[model samples]
Target: MVSFKKLTIRDILFRSRMAYYNRPSLAFVGQEPVTYADMAVIVRNVSGMLNTLGIGKGDKVALIGENSPNWGMAYLAITSMGAVVVPILPDFSGHEMESIINHSEAKVVFVSAKLYGQLDRKNIPGVIAYILINNLQPFDESVTTPTAGMPYETPKAIVNVDYCDCELPRPDEDDLAAIIYTSGTTGRPKGVMLTHKNLVSNVLSTLMIQEVNENDRLLSILPLSHTYECTIGFLIPMATGASVYYLDKPPTPAVLIPAMQAVKPTMLLSVPLVIEKIYKNKIKPELTSSSLKRKLYSFTPTRKLLHRIAAKKLHKTFGGELHFFGIGGAKLSFEAERFLNEGRFPYSIGYGMTETSPLLTGSSPKLVRFRTAGFSIPGQELKLLNPNPHTGEGEIIVRGANVMVGYYKDPELTQTMFIDGWLRTGDLGYIDSDGYVEIRGRSKNMILTASGENIYPEEIEDVINKHEFVLESLVYELRGKLVARVHLNKEALEKYYENLKHSAKDWQHNAEEHTRKVLDEIMNYVNAKVSKFSRLNHIVEQQEPFVKTPTQKIKRFLYKE
Candidate 1:
């Protein structure tokens, strides 16, 4: 076994092959699994192909695709050979994708078939070649043979090391490994420059807290372009020789339930939205249907017993072998968190951003505290800066090996984000005496009251979201007054109306009045619980669900006044 202390990703790949050569490594659920030996061959051939195309150390290669075995292979091949891998989120629009490709100055691009149409060749004229991720076929003027119009010859796989003639340059610990562009909720996207050391160090540090082994199986659902998934979901599992399964389609309940049963995954990586929806739509209805059931759920002892029963069913639905159900990307809803705690689910919360190689703090399932995102990972120091006197909340700053080198090509912007070598996270949080980190909200999103009080909208929104008729809520300050934009649960509201026969007469008018009344009721309910400054002055009905990032975080800037 090789020591992770000094090994880069390339070294780890070789070690994995030497030890678990024939073990199942990566696969799409229901698809044939790729062994470590085969994966090595693919990576080697891809590297050889890139070499033949005149790409080498420090060259940028953009990989845009949904999660697949090939996507993972392409990432390993690009980074292992001292080149930078630029992963574009597949959800990005055509213009956004082109902007990233041009901005990153990627010499070569590997795109999936589904996203191939998004690339405007004229926009990204700098790219020398474009290869389809589904199959390593190149499309470029340079790819044609000297005979003028003949397709480029695809590189053949070389199995025997003695017969191969490809030079693989070793990446230094500080070498730029990836340039991940932030899908910023506001402003233009900036590429986050992360080194090989940043990623490898974070991987090891995460494994120290959350133990994973060769026998562990991971079912990945989050976008691989997101650092949270790229690091822990893909890299950690690869480092530990764990088998990772990707969904063949979107991870909706219809597809996910069957796949879960098949994979029986030991570890599952997800954002809070997925589980929260399940709790709201599936579990909540069942719990609140009858007076007796509602009463049973209100009392502590009986509620916990009900939650335990529900949790067992949920566990069985998630393949029954789940040891770690890790959640991150956004704050988990209060109602869902309570159920998870009472039910004794193995789920835990993590907090980090793309700039930190995404794992700053995480809790183990056994040691998890409700609502907190666990302690800082080993080798990282998380501290609150400029704490408020009344409330200890302050901007979270972190310093560690896991931190990125800087934002790519934006030294001025990068300089502003750091103070004395510690990266300012911009997220407001507090660390308890026991070392758990509880995030309040983004510092930028905090509302400053007229009386000089700082109000976190997330806290208010959490309360509003707990209402039966509300699906999601956003709190923003409008002209120094707190206001809420809420997207109501249409299904729940319709069900309510259907139960009243008189409501069917002039339903449209009646529903409008009913909605207004409910919104007013919700506002009063929230205002009564919160402090005077934190109370919402108005609640505006949002006709549509707020647009969200890939992780399902509402794009706050999009809805900003």
Candidate 2:
């Protein structure tokens, strides 16, 4: 739907300037929004500042910050000025951030106030300047003062610039726009090089899945540094002149609930963990709180009715204006998808990686099914390599305008990332006769049985996650046998032993026995659903949350026993 002379970030920005100059662009919830016209001015000032600091086209400028209006401004200023933007995840450790910054060879760094203390000046000595992203002010250590182990000083830190008449370059479609470093579950971080065509084409392709306009509102809870949120959640909406709201803090219930009510967003982007938590922690418990309710929820018609009621309340809790809810970055639990479809909730699923501009296949709410990842987007061609004759599963390879150039500065690995010119997706899945995609699991995480059967641990873990007391479960191979690690719901565990808690003085041993009993029940339930080779031999308590990426996918490298 987007008409442009060339597929470039500059085209997206200036088109919005001409077509919707007065429209709202970005804002935090309950705050004044920056208009498109205002964005053009701010972007120019920021670009002018970068030029003043001796950074220009082809140079990399790093942005380390939480989501805010200024964060978007910094991104546009860097990319539209023909410089590459290197966005660092705010959740990364100080060491990780330093390594990424130095690796990218950034000329200037824009850091948020909250993360300034974490910036170690000893290692990343390549940075020429540091500007505060909150107020666009250039500062040095001589201007800062430390107090009580905290860096605090009025020190004229906030600089408000009004305008800049500096000239900016028009980038070609092949020009590099961003160098995004992904801390994946595989091994180490890799810098992904995305061109203007790769991103602009992806933003437009994703719009075919779900359209937005100047009137639509989006609440962004995901990190802007991740390609999934940056391309679809931020860039696509901005290209269509939609309003996007950010949360000043983390998206805990206390912050997100109020912000949703205030914005009443028409569209939202999220990973499965957000909805899974609401379903398991909130709706699932209420529907099965009593024997009669559990019986009713088991029946077909009654369960549908109950689901509809719960879905309605859930919709209202999101301010009752949601029309499209996109879940991506990881595979959603099957139990949650069934609830959404049966309940008539407006939910969709997508599949992609940071290497593919983050969107290869996705579905609108109308086309979504129980487990399908839906159809490939426009301008993308998909094929299976060495598919199983029985299951039709294989490595999902793709050729598309949206695929990244390659891993930045890693030609050796990038050469291995493709097979006969088709980019290897590293995902194992099948394309059905109806052209729908179903992703099984990652290839690296696949387990091989002694008899040579392919075992996808995700399938068994899906069943484990449905248990009432299970919050999340991980499946791995331990010495040729499948073992599961489950994080229990403390509230659910307490409620299960309410009688023993009040009546028995010696409750610790009783609690352990009860937990062991539930684990056995869950193991039996999962083994019955899976193939014999895929059955879990043991289910152990994890006791802590799994380490994860910014997108909420578990970091499997740590638990690959």
Q: Per-residue lDDT of 461-550 in model 1, one digit per residue for the tens?
A: 999999888899999988878899999998887788787664656567677888898899999999998998899999999999898887
Question: Model 2: number of clashes?
Answer: 0
Candidate 2, residue 132: how far the Cα is off, in Å: 0.5
Q: How accurate locally, in lDDT, is each candidate? A: 0.87, 0.87
Question: What tens-digit string does per-residue lDDT give for candidate 2 at 28-84?
Answer: 888888888888777777777888788878899999988888888889988988999
If scored against the real structure, what TM-score would every candidate get?
0.95, 0.96
Candidate 2 lands at a TM-score of 0.96
Question: Model 1, 359: alpha-carbon shift in Å?
Answer: 0.4
lDDT score for residue 504 of model 2: 43
